[model samples]
Target: MAGTTGGAAATAPGKKGETPAATRSGALKRLPLALLVFFAALLYSQIQPPPSKVPGAPGGPPVTAPRTRLRDGRHLAYLESGVPKEEARYKIIFVHGFDCCRYDVLNVSQGLLQELGIYLLSFDRPGYAESDAHPARTEKSIALDIAELADNLQLGPKFHLIGFSMGGEIMWSCLKYIPHRLAGVAILAPVGNYWWSGFPADVVEEAWYVQFPQDQRAVWVAHHLPWLTHWWNTQNLFHSSSVKGKNPIILSKEDTALSQKFLDRTYKEQVRQLGEHDSLHRDMMVGFGKWGWSPLEMENPFAGAGDEVKVHLWHGVEDLFVPVQLSRYISKKLPWVIYHELPTAGHLFPAADGMPDVIVRSLLLGDE
Candidate 1:
């Protein structure tokens, strides 16, 4: 091969009437192109996007469907599944996670909801899905939205609550403010509050170190500089939360597939156009902010319920998004929370097939 290449090179210079100087000139000309390619690749590999400016739409287009009006005049778009309100033997409210809306309910079977007489309602939080944005939304205020939503619909004196991921983190607010109105509560694979002072140093260290560096920065920014939450998530020059990425805060292949439905292109563009202040950013700001109390400081919320009011906490053993160690610490501190630590599951465990039935049944029908 070497002899053949040398013969071709010799023939090309002689037969083509090309001078040695010309050949050298051609080689020199190609050198800069190669360098340009190398440098372009180097820069491409190093460059990254910036965090958003205050965090915009959390995705899913504004709801075009008729929306229910809360007393405060803000509107919420919701989806209802299973039995009608009156025929419902079990009325449950599902709080969706970050970057999702009313459409992203659990993978529960219609047969199960019908057979069990379960009426599940999922709604968009203010500032998402055409739900009127609440400029002054706080942790307590958002929780009140849930209570008022129930009251407006007249969902009787009490209803069951199921919160997934970010939904689960804020579920604490409901436990704090509206425990009397809850028949039961199920928190699934909740996003842990790393800034919560209740966690031990070792537990916090273990969980914080396991997170992807970008997510660590995201948490750090959200906790320390709440004002920069949007920019920290949307800027084009730095790493941000996986919330808007291909693999959100999930760890399993099953969860990966579950996330695609939320990360659709058309869905993203639709919501991005609204340019509303995002409820999810508020979730991050309040989620890591000083809540004045911690779940570790919580008494059994169901302690005084006249009827059976079970509080179930389901977490995945393999969950790295929020780490099982933190959940373990929480369960230990609040022993009344019935902890279900599933083996080999990840952050999106709540979306697994047949899991919804399991969670609801455990919450209402007892742990049969």
Candidate 2:
């Protein structure tokens, strides 16, 4: 009767299916293959890097260099990347940040100007890279070096200047001193926010002395920039989040999700490395007080300068080091300047994903 009713579940003892060992064996055999495919995809993605140039790039004309010297006898390193002596309307000078080599900004300027037929020159700041450090580094002294570099390079009567981070402060000094010489200027993530801070300059400056009383001028930055970059990053990010304007483009769902994950992971890793340095307290004080406030003090100089100097400013609304609030402050004060509040960028540009394009376009095409 059972045989006639015939259900496959009616198995005998010897044929009671294969043992669990067989199931375990099958999974173990396939595990290596699955991992191999996963890693292969990752390797393939890395092999093909992003395109090296912007869309519709008409490469710049050939460049030439003529021998020149600085008055201070300091041998400055520079590369001339456009047809020199060709009376171009604008000769652009790029100024880098503290402790940064010329190579840092060169990597950016070279690409843009090389493809756009624009004149660009970048050099190491004193105490950095190949350029000779000043016996004493001060706002005024550094400005002199830059002005001299421009003269030596014989860029042009009309020139544009772009500066980033600490370089922004230096750029301001140069702009103020050489008011008649510049045709335009652009500041990226300029760091002097002391005026906007709740604390007074005297209080802020005094705090710096306490934190780094003996180490004011000596070189003291986090050896590992990627790790110690958080303090700076945080300031920019907090500022970026606060920007309000006419219908800023919102991130798509996929980008929003992916960005959140990346930000969380990056922030954690950066914070974890923070314990290695004990200099944060002093660094912040000197940075916010002295280094940061210098530019705001010079803002008044732009008032009476002749010539229509077009100024363009772009900063991530999410920037942590230099907040968007600072950008907003400058935009309000300098009526001639146009500010673009980027919705999804951090402090690192020209190297970060979306920022390099915004920066280059802003510098090249104005605020539109």
Best-matching candidate per lDDT: 1
Off by over 4 Å in 2: 1-69, 82-89, 106-116, 193-294, 297-307, 353-358
How much is the lDDT of residue 221 in candidate 1? 83
lDDT of 2 by residue, 1-368 (tens): 77744544343322456445665687789999999999988755543322221111243111122323567665555655553537444477877653344544534444555565667677755433334334344556666777777877666566778887667655667766776677677777665534443445564464334322212222122222322222332333232111111012333333343344334443232211212112222222334334433444445445676536667776666554444565666666666677776687654544554555456556666636
Q: Which regions of candidate 1 deviate over 4 angstroms? A: 1-63, 247-250, 257-273
- Could you give candidate 1's per-residue lDDT for residues 264-348 as a string of tens digits? 5355543433342356666677777766777788888777664588888989887767778888889999977889998878787
* TM-scores of all predicted structures: 0.79, 0.53
Residue 167 local lDDT, model 2: 71
Candidate 2, overall lDDT?
A: 0.51
